[model samples]
Target: MTNRIVDHPVLGKLTNRPPVTFTFDGKTYEGMEGDTIASALLANGIRQLRVHEGTGTPRAIYCNIGHCFECRVTVNDAKIVRACMTPIQNEMVIESGKMQPAPFKASPEEWPRTYAEFEKMNDNHKEGVPHA
Candidate 1:
């Protein structure tokens, strides 16, 4: 698809630069050097990147920034990375669906299975160290 950012309301004619091509789920798309992965996908008319793990529903960018995890996608074998924050690189492979088996499994290093556990851990922490 055409990577040229013609005329956007707020962005307003994205600056022309060296074009780079990459694939999203096997479809080629062109984007500028400075565009984030999300921006490039949006420019190429790709809204939904992956399906939700539990619900299997379509999901895409939510906050447009890294604050929300809705835009998570597998990049070059790395899972759960924020797509909006990642810049497109040459030959990068972006895949849909939550990475199977999870990169982190049954590991205390990946704590807080639920938000409540995260909150509890946060409450017990002092100087960024959890109470032992």
Candidate 2:
């Protein structure tokens, strides 16, 4: 009942890789040794990896290509890694991000943009809008 395709018309058959055991949200699950955490979760029909930081709505893999940070999850209670980019490993503790009551607040420390730099950036976008 997995969504994973074992055989493809172009790639023929995908060899069965060694089984890897891991836990997601405290529930044990099995995945192929080389599968990414996101793929493993999707194969097992466990979507909704985490909630949106701005809105408490549930979110799954949006771009799967690692460009988007929508699939971020905590690993081993310490590191926050993108599930779509992180490979599955044995006994890895994966936890979904907890829901936030309010939207994430951006700070100068995180962005590090000076007021002058911000003004210059804003000025560049002025041409795109019609003036009153």
TM-score of each: 0.66, 0.72
Off by over 4 Å in 1: 1-5, 8-12, 98-132
Model 1: per-residue lDDT, tens digit, 52-86? 77557789999986997898888888988788999
Best model number under lDDT: 2
lDDT of 2 by residue, 20-68 (tens): 8989999999889889999999888899998876557898899989898
Q: Which regions of candidate 2 fall more than 4 Å away from where they truly are?
A: 103-132
Model 2 backbone overlap count:
0
Q: What is candidate 2's TM-score against the reference?
A: 0.72
Q: How high is the CA lDDT of each candidate model? A: 0.78, 0.83
